[model samples]
Target: MQTIVYDETNKINEQAVQWMEDLLNFAADKLNVAEHAEVSVSFVDNAKIKEINREYRDKDAVTDVISFAIEDDEEDLFKEFEGSGITIPRDLGDIFISYDKAVEQAEEYGHDINREIGFLLVHGFLHLNGYDHMTVEEEKIMFSLQEEILRDYGLKR
Candidate 1:
C-alpha cells in the first residue's frame, strides 16, 4: 500500500502522479518487492522547501525535490530483505517538491510541466530507494533508470 500525501493541492500534476505510480510499480517489480510501502509527496513553495533544506541539510537554497529515507536507520527493517528478496515496508518516506522551482525549470528546459514533474518525482523516488549521484557511474545508473522509467510510462524526451 503506497500512499501519496501532499502538503498542499496538486490539482495540476495529475499526469506526473500517474507516471509516479508506474515508476514505483516498475521499481518494485525490478527489485522483487512485495509488501506495503507508504510515501508522502508534498507540493511546497520555494520558501518552505528552502527552510526545510536549511534546517535539515544546512543548505540555504530552494531545491527542486527532497526525500527523507528513514529505512537507513532501521536495522531490523531489512533483516533479510536483500538476502531473502522480500519487500517489507510500512511507510517509505516523503518526497517534497517545489512547484515554483518545477515551473521555472520546465520553462527553462522548454519541456512540458508534466515531463518536468515526472522527472522530479522519479528523481526523488530514486533517492528514497537509495539511489544517489555521489559518483559519475552512480549518477549514470540513477539517471538512466529515471529516463528509462519515464520512457516506459510514455513520458518521452
Candidate 2:
C-alpha cells in the first residue's frame, strides 16, 4: 500500500506525516488491501476544505474530511483488466483532511492531535472502501469498525 501525503497547509511536520503513512499501512494490512494499492492524503486548511465541500457536496460548511473513491465509479472497468497479465495498481482514491478542524476536534474531544488525525484518516479510508454512515444501522457498523481499527492501532480515546 502506497500512501502519498500532501501537506497543503504546510503546518504538518515530518513526524506527523510519517505517522500517517505508518497508520495507513497498518490500516491496509488490517483491511486486506492489495499490495499494489495507492492512495493520496492531502492536508489542507479550513478555507480550502470548505471550498472543496461546497463544490463537491454543495455544502458551504467546512468538513473534517472528504474521500473520493476511484473504485466507486470504475470498479467494473478494473475488473475487466484483471487476470489479463496487466499489473494495474489499485488506485483507491484521494482523502482530503482539514488541518484546522483536526486541531479543534482534538481539543474538543480531549485527545491528542495524532488521535484525531488518525481517526479522520481511518474514517476517510473506510469511506474509500465503501463504508457509509447514512443510516442508523450503517452508522453503527461503520463507527464500530472505525473504533475497532483505531483501538487496534493504539489511537484510543
Candidate 3:
C-alpha cells in the first residue's frame, strides 16, 4: 500500500512513528489501496504550518492538516510508477501538523500524547485518501472514519 513516509526534520519520538504507520495502514485498509501504494506526511511547527496554510490555501492560520492528491490520467488517487508492479506512490501528498497545536490540544482534551498523535495521524491520512470535513455530510463520514481508525488503533482515551 501507499505507506506513510514521515519527514522527520521536525523531531519525532518513537510513538509518533508508530502512530503514523498505524494510521496509514488504517487508511490503506479502509480505502482499499493496493499493495505498494505510497503516502507521505510531514510534522511541522505552528509557524511552518501557518506559512503552508497561507501560501497554498490562502488561509492565514495554522491548521491541523492539508492534503494534496497527486492525480493520474485516470484520475486515480495513486499513480503507477514506471514498469514496477507497485502502484504509483499515492504521492498521496503531505500533511502538515503543528506539534505545538497537537500538544496543546492534547492537554486541553485531557488525553495522552500518543492518543492525540494517533488522532491527528488518522485525520491527516483520511484527508490524503479523499476525506474532508468541508460540509456536514462530509464531516460525518470523515469523522466516523477517523474515529473508527483510531479505535482500531486503540487510541481512544
Q: Highest lDDT, which number?
A: 2
* Model 3 alpha-carbon miss at residue 35, Å: 1.5
Candidate 1 vs candidate 3: the lDDT winner is 1
Per-residue accuracy of model 3 over 110-152 as CA lDDT, tens digit each: 9986777678777877776677899999999999988887887
Q: Write the per-residue lDDT of candidate 2 for residues 44-89, one digit (tens) a residue.
A: 9999999999999999999999999988765375777778999888
lDDT for 43 (candidate 3) = 76
Task: Give model 2's TM-score versus the native structure.
Answer: 0.94
Q: Give each model a TM-score.
A: 0.82, 0.94, 0.82
The candidate maximizing TM-score is: 2
Clashing pairs for model 3 are 1-36, 1-37, 2-37, 2-38, 79-88, 80-88
TM for candidate 3 is: 0.82
- Residue pairs in clash, model 2: none
TM-score-best of 1 and 3: 3
Q: Please, what's the RMSD in Å of model 3?
A: 3.0
Candidate 2 wrong stretches, greater than 4 Å: 73-75
lDDT of residue 20 for candidate 3: 74
